[model samples]
Target: MKKLLAECLGTFTLVFAGTGAIVINAATHGSITHVGIALVFGLVVLAMIHTFGDVSGAHLNPAVTLAFAAARRLPWREAPGYVVAQVAGAFAASLLLHFLFPQDTTLGATLPLGSDAQSFVLELVLSAILMLTILSVSTGAKEKGITAAITIGGVIALEALFAGPISGASMNPARSLAPAFISGHLSHLWLYLTAPILGALLAVPLCLCVRDSTCCCASPTSGKS
Candidate 1:
């Protein structure tokens, strides 16, 4: 229960602050700029990880939760609850944004600036890199502490900086889903939903190859011989 609440609150804050930057930038005629928006996403994620890291691992991203489960760091049973909390939180944030900015369209929903195929490949690679970084920095299923927060936050910021103009640097299904659903920008939504998951899953094999087998793969026995 506490974990779910933490996930919800953390995700809500993520969407509210991150997408709010986009909405405000558009409303104010680019006062925030692309760089500023990227920084906001990164900083907010850093803050959330610090705030809720101890409680719920501060997933705030369904791709991340699923990746952790695939990596055997997190139990599969908890993935659904985390995903639900994240999506609910994201929707809550988007709904609030809609209320505040009634005339605003898209509400910072991620859209492909290029062809769907281009954005799809970009999202996949970006998510894989992000997931690999998370796996390296995280402890078991939990992404808490200063190291995890800074490294993970840095990776997100970096990716968004480079990829925001292309694929909106979504990297998270819940983050993309809420605004798209609310703002009626559903076209090309399938790529955002599928690519990131596939990318994160792809990272599992890569991690297993580079990391210790015990760290990346689940073991059935307690003893090591």
Candidate 2:
């Protein structure tokens, strides 16, 4: 229960602060800028990992949770709960944003700025890189402590910086889902949902190849740190 609550709260904070930057930037005519928005997402992720990481492993992204389970670091049984908590929190944030910015069209939903194929490939590669970093830094399923927070946050920021223009850098299904659902921008939603999962799953085998067998195939650990 505590873990679920932590995931919910952590995900809520992430979506609220990150997407709020986009909404506010649009409302204010780009005061925040693309770089600023990317930084906001990175910084908020750093803060959340520090805040609730010990409680829920800060699996605020469903892709990360599923990847950990696939890597045998987290039990499969726990993945669904974490995903649900993340999605619920994301929806809560998007719903609030919708209410606050009633005239806003997308509410920070991720959309493909180019061809769907282009964004899809970018999202897949970006998610793979992000998951690789997480798998490298994490302990079992948990992404806690200073190292995990900084490295994971930095990777997210970097990816968003480069790929935000094309793919919106949505490496998380829950993060992409909420705003798309609320704002009714579902045309390219399938790419965002499927690519990240496939990418994260791809990282598992890559981790096994590069890392020691024990590192990627360790016995499942408790969800908490």
Candidate 3:
């Protein structure tokens, strides 16, 4: 139950803040550029990691959690609970955004069906890099020995700046899911889901290799191994 709650709250923090950035991005009327949105989004992840990473690894994204599950970093039984919590948290955030900003049409969600294929592929690649960085910094090799909050936040910030324009840089399935629920668009939902998962999947082995390198004193198992 504690783990489930942790997942729920962590996901809530992610969607609430991430989607909030989208709201800011659109409503700011050019005040908040892509860089600004990415920064805010990254900060949100950084903050939540400190608050919830210890309890549930702060896996606010279904894709990230799923990757961990596939790698056996997390139990399979917990996957559904985590995904459910993530989706529900995202949905609740969306509802609140709807209430607070009822007049706004966009929910700060992601869709790539109509977007250029090249752009979509670029987004996927960027997302992979971000996920791999998160795995490395948070887990092993380049653990950096920094606080989880700072490291994850920095990762998110970089990802946002580079990938926000392409595919909305939605490396998170839950982040994309919430907006789709409210905005009534599922056209490219699969792209967001599949691409991010693939990115995460690729990161698993690469992170393993990097973490195994003898640059650090700690063993690979110490981090995400």
lDDT of 1: 0.91
Which residue pairs in model 1 clash with each other?
none
Report the C-alpha displacement of residue 12, candidate 2, in angstroms: 0.8
Q: Please report how far candidate 1 places residue 113 from its true position, in Å.
A: 0.7
Scored by Cα lDDT, where does model 2 land? 0.92
- TM-scores of the models, in the given order? 0.96, 0.98, 0.85
Q: Regarding TM-score, does 1 or 3 come out ahead?
A: 1
The TM-score between candidate 2 and the true structure equals 0.98
Top TM-score prediction, candidate number: 2
lDDT of each residue in 112-182, candidate 3, tens digit only:
53465755576568667877766665542122344756877887788777666667878888888778878
lDDT of 2 by residue, 52-119 (tens): 88888897999999999999988889889989999999999999999999999999999998899999
In order, what lDDT does every prediction score? 0.91, 0.92, 0.72
Worst 10 residues of 2 by lDDT: 216-225
Off by over 4 Å in 1: 219-225
Hey, what RMSD does candidate 3 come out at?
Answer: 3.9
Which residue runs of candidate 2 sit more than 4 Å off their true CA positions?
Answer: 223-225
Which one wins on lDDT? Answer: 2
Residue 66 lDDT in model 1?
93
